[model samples]
Target: MTTTQSLPHWNMDVVYPGLQSPEFAQGFAATVKEIEALVQLFDASHVEKQDVLTVDDGLIKTFETAVEHFNSVQDHVLTLEVYISCFVSTNSRDEVAQARESELENSLVKLSQLDTRFTAWLGSMDVEQLIAHSEVASAHAYALRRAKAESLHMMSPREESLASELNVSAGTAWTKLHANLTSQLNVTLELDGQTQQVPMSVVRNQASSTDREVRRRAFEAELAAWKEVAVPLAQALNSIKGEVNTLAHKRQWESALDASLFANSIDRQTLDAMLSAARASFPDFRRYFRAKAQALKIPQLAWYDIFAPLGSSDRVWEYSDAERFIVEQFGTFSERLSNYAARAFSEGWIDAEPRAGKRDGAYCTPLRKDESRIFTNYKASFDGVSTLAHELGHGYHNLNLAERTALQSFLPMTLAETASIFCETIINHAAMKDADREERMAILEASIQGACQVVLDITSRFLFEQNVFEQRKQRELSVEELNGLMLQSQRDTYGDGIDQQTLHPYMWAVKGHYYSSDLSFYNYPYMFGLLFGLGLYARYQQNPEAFKQGYDELLSSTGLDDAATLAARFGIDLHSEAFWRGSLDIVRQDIDAFCELVQSQA
Candidate 1:
């Protein structure tokens, strides 16, 4: 949380003193030493733990005993790795950190190999045997079952190894290239009668500027900057998607979309229902946008104006005030959640500054043995509370899974937003409930504005990616061609609400989601997160006590079951368009209220 008092960057000193610290050196050495033990033990245990269906004490001596130990060493290894992630995130250019990270990554290969072997080994065992094994089996039951199910797609160990190596030079390389390209990007903006070089991150934040001239100039500067890297970025995107296309085809998948579904452990029917629901909800979204345009005193909104603040007083806060608001609001929900945020803020578990090297977005990274650390480029804007709440929501999610085995705590995109978005909804509702007429209108406007982005703008991103892949099949897309596709997607998704002439054409260039070969169509998951979160919030609204237990169960079971299976806990059928539309309907209700508020003033 940002305060008037200077905030400190995350104290990696707790993880280790420094790159040259004995703790860092010893931790890395211990991890490598532990990896060797895991490797030798995994190899030797095969001779002992026969794939017998027996669940006797002899079987426990053979496999389960060894697995519990393996998990212990594995947790230590993870703690070391996550420390490196924290080290590099705030200072990407630390050569010592970078060099050590590369070294640690190489050592991690052995651990990964052992994991694959373990997964494959479990795949051969009968379900009843796993259930009978007790401790380790009960702890990581979902992870083991998921691995066994996915072992259907497993290549040979040697082939899998080669595939990973190829990804390093192929897909991973391009993602890195995109990161390096964007971070180094210099956009010159003429402000206050002088020219200054702006980092791409700083320039993009200007889109939310209250001053229209500044917003327009910033957009222009960002466009100019993106132009310099457009060719390379286009190539980067083409290469990344092309690699996925090649891999999926070789793997006998129908398409990259199919591969994405499998990786997320979700079915095509659910995705179809979600996307179709999004497209159908466009009319209501446009209506909200039209009302917003009136509220902003414009006929229609422009690309830069999309994020522009609507009210005259764009409230900023002291860091202390921000902390109190968040803690009090969270306490209104539950004491457990408030305690997590209190600890995160008090313990310096967050990097809360807008520094040059820190990443643009906020994320909570889970360290299984310890707690999660949140990273954000904090500025005490009106939206700062939402950002803090969102991250703390993630922290709370981590806290729920903290006591569980590391393997069982993995959350996929579908349920990952459950806590974070729900936290946002809680805080948003509280703020709106307490505000005066002027403040209430402003708050609702801001809330609906963000809702428009996730629901409508996210859909536009999905369409743009679909078009990009289709066009990218024959040849690489030129900057103009890519820009054309983006504008068309925006028109198709946003319809007449967003002024076409002022749409962001170079959106594909800045967004890192497009660059990830691993998470194809990274856009819709956010839509799912928002809508899924809303759906759960609705349940909470009905019976807070009943929903609280079910909500915790849902988050805990995310890694255990697929999207459709987990939704069943709340009697949700994700495959039904009606289920998704139910969430959209909630948004429509909010929009209607906002529109009425604005029109009453008229």
Candidate 2:
């Protein structure tokens, strides 16, 4: 197993050696001065409701210049803070180090004021005049439109600024509390005639144990531990959602989903289509779940039982072996992806190891001026290899978009999954091709296990979030009410496949995605990304030579256009159910082969 020592060396010194550096001082002072100047130019009386279309050439040019400068300064400062905080988080455990983190947090909190001022100024622009500014009209037109849409949800500038600041102490603080409680909560799992304190991550992974007794124990202990903190966490979630709803009402918006979707830059039509496809695909999911339950010899599968091993195959790859396997598989599909993965490993780009005090889970952060950075906790298991592919896919996506400006390089949630899922598909396809019968069973089970989580499990989360919003409008949700809603959502999605008695009721409290104040309906985007990526992968399989170029072009163009246009380049129509069904058909084919393979073994 890889340890914390294998993580990337934090290189904040590349920006500046310390806060005392001349570069840091100059950049910090310059950003503050610039923000003050922009605030002074916000002529509230004349600018209110004045569209950029009607603004004179001089004023328009001035506005454009101010925006560019403001964005540039804001991006640089925010990026620097992120780099520093990540460094601090990875290394510092002492009080002084923590105090330094507090300082950075406070500074970032203060900068939230500038965010409100800028948004209000942008909102104050006359619709036509803003649209008519040639510079703004030509480039980043989508961003400009999105800003205007979001601004429509704003209250008076004063209230908006207060909300921005209060969020630091409200939703943000409660989430921090939840993080602390969960990380420190230990489940005293009785194993091997001894009591051992198990972390949540270890307990969750135990559900994959080939030993049924172990999984049952882990599952029971895991949920039991949550009872200790579920009440406070429930309060945290309800409070945050309440604020989101009230803010939406104040802005005269129709719903929280509408505001969130606008920020996500997706439309209701696409969301509805995605949910419909997920619902329609339940039969395929149920088939796989039933097969697994039979294979495991269980009367009925429970939530953790869904990950129960179907075969006694145990194949472990070392870290280097995992890397080589991923790169080779990715290369087989596309040289572009292979080359990116190779560079990510050869260069000091990947932080592919687990460590104490490091944040759990995996992510790939792309630095506009430098190479992308990948983080993961590797346990030398099959899932770890899949994680490597997933994160490297993100790195490759970043590499493809490296030439674009930072503002233009950011892809929305819908299309962000394309490169990542393509990478995963390449690995899964290769495994299916090369593995022996037992190995194939393991790999297929793993893939299906993950897919069900992304599709079926995510569907439950979507339903739960929807119900929470509806009930929240009436009144706040107590812990008991919240748990009931969660179980209902799971039952709806899992149906007869999952035993209701053993379903995870603390799911909403554990998932951090629900706590986000900004991103509502975050659940469905996973299904959209996965199915969309599968559709693209299917196209690539048909004509590898021709489609490879098209795939690369699609990724490069993702930042430049909306999801629909970007997908259309690959002959995909986001609006059509047929398109999503075509993608699900590919997964169905996999499930078919895996079923036959398992039956032959029996």
Candidate 3:
């Protein structure tokens, strides 16, 4: 068995020697001072809502100065926050890190207030005129315009300020509670005739085990452990969702989903188009699921079997092998991407181990423009290798945006998944090229499993969150109610592909996405990213040189425009169902091939 100690831990020393080091302390103090200076700048410039129709040269210069200052301060603030989050996320039991995070959040209330005031001021002024007059404003035209539009839903300055102050104890606290509880959670199971307790993340990773009994035991033990902590987790969910609902109402948004649409910089038409195509592909996904069940020689797939390995592989995907495979596959597309992956590996940028107190799942966060850290709970499986490819894709995206200003690189979640998914495809496709029949079957199964999650499972999550928000508006939902809603969502989307008796009911507690108050409806963007990426990959296949030349530019410009506008640049119509279906067709072809392989093997 691989221990966490053997796996690589990220090098935070490059960012700062330690959280308590003098360099970090100086940076933190300097950021606070900068925030104070920013407030003074805003006050001196009278950066508030205005009734004037046009701006003079003097006012334009003031606006430019304020924009530049705000951008600089924001960059520093994000770096500090990301640095703290690295420690807090890696170990939930770190009291000092948790305290520091809370203190930081509290300190930022004033900055958040200043942001609200600035947005309201922009909302009241002629943003287009300002953009025309100032070079800085012109460069940040999209973000400025977005702020102006968002200001329509803003509360009074005092109200917004108060909300920001209270969030530290309210929504943020609840989110922290959820993270701490889930990270520290442990499941007890009997393996090899001995009872052992393992972290919930470790147990969850067993879902892909080739042994049926191990998967079954892990799933049941996971549910039992969650049941023990369901009450507090339920309260955490209610609090976060309740806060989101109240804020959405106060801000005058139509619904939580409506607010999410604005946050993602996507319109309703785009969402509808993507979902319409996803719904149409449900029958095909079910076919793949049923075929997997047949290959497993099961009557129907249980929830535990969703990620079960479908074919045998004599080779174990150790960490070193995963590293080599990813770099080799990435080089097939572009040298820049390949070099980025190699740097991440050699520079100790990934923390790939599961252990007590460490968070579940995986994410890649930017430490600076040119650097990023990836976290994953790696198991010795192909899925683990694919996860590395996915996150390195995110790192590559960050590298492309290195030259842009902080505000210019603030991409919406919808486009954030593009590079990650694209990189994942590269690795999957490359692996298939050299594999023997059995190896090919394993690779294809892993590929389709990912698509099913993005397409089928993500639909269920979208439905579940939508229902939760709607019900949460009326009142708080109990644990049983949340579980029931989860089961209903699974049944609705999974249909007959999964056994009704074996559906996972506690999924709401298992997934961390639901516990975030700041980002709601975090589910659908993944679907958008998957389909969009596959579509881009198809485009790349048609014209490799042209696509390669423009790919980095597209990533670098994600924050510069809305998702639809970016899609238009590539001649992809986001509003057209056919465009999304084209992406789905790629997955469908894979499903067809998978079904044929399963049948032949059977």
Which stretch of 10 consecutive residues in model 2 shows the poorest summed lDDT?
A: 44-53
Off by over 4 Å in 2: 1-53, 84-102, 105-137, 191-193
TM-score of each: 0.93, 0.90, 0.98
C-alpha lDDT score of every prediction, in listed order: 0.78, 0.73, 0.90
| Alpha-carbon RMSD, each predicted model | 2.7, 3.3, 1.4
Instruction: Write the residue-wise lDDT of candidate 2 on 1-602 in tens digits.
Output: 22322434434565556656788667656655655564555443232233343456765776666556656655665555565555544433334444545555555554566555555556666645666656664565665555566677678867876887787777776666665556556677877778898666666667777778888998899888888888889988888888888988998889888876665556888778777877898988888887887778778888878777654246665777777899888878767778878877777666654444545566777754436777776655677788789888887887787765555665777777778888988887787786777878888887887788888999999899989988899898988899999999999999988887988899997787788776677787778888988988888878888897677777777767778877777788888888887888877787887778767766
- In Å, residue 298's CA in model 1 sits off its true spot by 2.1
lDDT of model 2 at residue 598? 62
Error of 1 at 135 (Å): 4.7
What is candidate 3's TM-score against the reference?
0.98
Residue 337 lDDT, candidate 1, scale 0-100: 82
Ranking by lDDT: 3, 1, 2
Candidate 3 lDDT score at position 3: 29
> Which runs in model 1 stand beyond 4 Å of their true positions?
1-5, 46-62, 132-135, 368-370, 470-475
- TM-score-superior candidate, 2 or 3: 3
Q: At residue 44, give the lDDT of candidate 2.
A: 33
Candidate 1's residue-wise lDDT over 1-602, tens digit each? 12467866886677788888898898889889888877778777772223544456765566675677677777787778788877676766666876787787666666666666776666666745766667767766777678767655666667656666676667877987787677667679976678998677778778777777888899989988888889999989999988877767766777888777776767888999998988888998888778878987878878888777765345666677778888899988788888888888898888877656555677887765448888877766557667778888888887877766657766777678878989988888888877887777767766777788898998889889988877777888788998998988888988888887888889998888999877898888888988988888898898899887777667767777678888888888899999899998888888898889889887
Model 1: how far is 166 from its true place, Å? Answer: 2.7
Give the worst 10-residue stretch by lDDT in candidate 3: 1-10
